[model samples]
Target: MTAGASYHGQPVIKAPVWTWQIPWYFFTGGVAGASAGLGYLCELRGDDALARRAWAAAMAGICVSPALLIADLGRPQRFLNMLRMFKVTSPMSVGTWILQGSAASTAIAAAHAWFGLFPRLARVAAPAAALLGLPLSTYTAALVTNTAVPVWHEARRTLPFVFGAGAGLSAGAAALIGADPATAAPARRLALGGAAMELATTTLMHRGLGEHGRPYSQGRCKHFDQAASGFLAVGSALLAARGSRSRTAAAAGGVLLLAGAVSTRWSVFAAGRQSAADPHAVIDPQRAGIARGERIGGARTEPVARDAAAPAGPAS
Candidate 1:
């Protein structure tokens, strides 16, 4: 154990204030962003039926996402206040605008695709939505990682990919519902690829986190992680084997993938909170850096002795 590391054995950082809604928002935002991109790809391929379904799913996700975010803030006005100014340096600021743009662009594209209105606008909006979707889908990873949280900051390299994969999995799964065999192939491929990538990236994140990954591997977070992996694995297998031929199989696989997406977000969020609640999660890493003779914040790691002239404080 490092000397002078503990402060009454208490956590140095406060746990995140975000609640259940944030994870749901993350899941839905990812779905909305990925679905828009998938829809545009389907449109380019002249698969209007599949494109419409993807856009519709994007619309549904974007619509639900804001409500979840607003609910988390505990006031619609607080959410609106975020739109008052844009800060390129702030992940939260950029993410808020991305969500807003995604909501509008997706709604417009879905309307045109579904109701056959404003073809010219959709031609412009569809590709725009797809472009914005890339950032929208993965920006939440930046938001969480920008904080002092050990688990999130340490796994920053791969968490975006994890979130992106979860988004693709959920979006593709949603599109697979009620789609015919011929038109469902693309969605099935998307879902399968997403599930595989999600599993791989999540593993990579945990491995990369090293000692800081305990929150992900132990206790309640471990269960969430296991559920995510199991669901993605089973769902992908089911989709790969029979999804193309059977609508029922496709729908079932899609449902599992959606569940996996939710579990992925929940696991990541919970792990970050758990890490924050554990003081050692912060201290040990710094101590390890000091042991390596690394300078932290340009300050020497050597302990400083108290001055002889200093006055003593009363004990608590």
Candidate 2:
């Protein structure tokens, strides 16, 4: 099938209705989740100051996350309504609870570290928040892949890792914004590690996507993807060279890392939208499957037509 071939040349699927707020929500939610997880690890290592800053970063990200989600939803109540169910099969339902639990636990942990409150609750909440953070960082990948969007669905296996890397990068960058060079050492390491992982996983994801990945490399979508990679690379380089010795370098690198992470989310979201809008994104994949003798939708490769005037044959 050619690109122009479809049901009368219309899109095979509707483009997503999501807007700018969704990408922002993804970025912040990722930062919150990664920060919580990193904070717990730092606490276990007895790096109290670094852990405190991490919790604070988690608090800040969580605060922005819900507001962005609510804005996208057009109402605060709609966000709350998602928590009404805990369906195991639904990514959105599971993610909603993860966000809620992460927010509450981070808040408790942050309060204890910053204001000296809730000492007993903080111990349990801290670990709980860290545990929830892993899914919270990458569940958006599952949510999008669960849909019919060709680009997203094709990259499902690696998207979570890419998202997790972005989360770590952004959280580390946010943490680097404050504190001395010595205190920011761990954050720098996290950011650099995330940048490397993101670069590797993203390359593999695009390679695995084959023709379905066109949106990420063509038109305006290409620019966003390039910017994401560029920012992360430059940020990581700067951090490695001077982040441990200079606060100024660390802060600037941190800003670039955040920009890179945000751009990564935006590029992925835009690519999915573009793929959904293109008919060939859906048609070409199925046609290839048919060529490979793979049954589509568990049905036969050839269409079966019945004659209304003739007697119907018995079921096989």
Candidate 3:
């Protein structure tokens, strides 16, 4: 009935339309993580202005992430409620707190950049921000991998590295796709690295999950997402492997990587919702596993409780 919205009958999915929060999380996480890595690379290359801008972007990304999460939730106040319980086993909580740390580092990095520009205030924020950004970039990966969702949760082995690669690629794309030669070199390298990382991680992620892979690997969404990701990975690798660098190629490659990253997020989000929607995803495998275990002979089971044991025990 609305101008832009489709009637899917109360938000259920013929295919997944996972809200903007999913993309926001993907983009913001990549931006923040990539910015942090870019800042470090800037320091190594001795480009202070670019370094400063990267930090500012990191701050911006961090600041926006929590707001997006709150907005996505039907009840905003529930986000605050996460702090009430301390559950290390819960990545949701860990991710929320990581955002806090990321924000603080971003602020410090900005201050450092400002001071480096001023020269007189160099002692204040630079060193601290530089130190913090490293962890900030990496922890975002841990945050995603710790979830219970099969596609995401099972990606624990390689998710952090994949995320890191995406972040680095995004940072490179933002900094280097322009005409300036100074930012271009580092940007190019970062993009190549990102492309490689994502490709490898994606391959590993898919290979790692065999028959349990319907969520991301099946359906119409998968066709676009998988191809998009594969193309980006290949394009980036080609750019990386080439002896002579082409700006046009680099730009296009970066765009491909960015597109791939977006699709990766979309696929992941849709898949998770799908996984949750079907009870068979949870029930069927579990029942089968239980049946298999029950068939095993001579396995000593745990003792029954006092109530169940009473009948097994002597009367009275």
Query: How accurate locally, in lDDT, is each candidate?
Result: 0.89, 0.88, 0.63
**lDDT: which is higher, 2 or 3?**
2
List pairs with backbone clashes in candidate 3. none
Candidate 3 Cα outliers beyond 4 Å, as residue runs: 1-18, 77-87, 114-148, 234-249, 291-316
lDDT for 111 in candidate 1 is 90
lDDT by residue for model 1 over 144-192, one digit each (tens)? Answer: 9999999999888899999998888888999998889777888888898
Q: What is the lDDT of candidate 3?
A: 0.63
Q: Give candidate 2's error at residue 142 in angstroms.
A: 0.6
The order by descending lDDT is: 1, 2, 3
Off by over 4 Å in 1: 1-5, 297-316
Write model 3 residue lDDT over 10-83, tens digit each, in one string. 32223333477856577677777668667756766788766766776676777777788788877887878877
Name the regions of candidate 2 deviating beyond 4 angstroms.
74-76, 296-316
* Ordered list by TM-score, greatest first: 2, 1, 3
The stretch of ten residues in a row with the least summed lDDT in candidate 1 is 295-304
Weakest ten-residue segment in model 3 by summed lDDT: 1-10
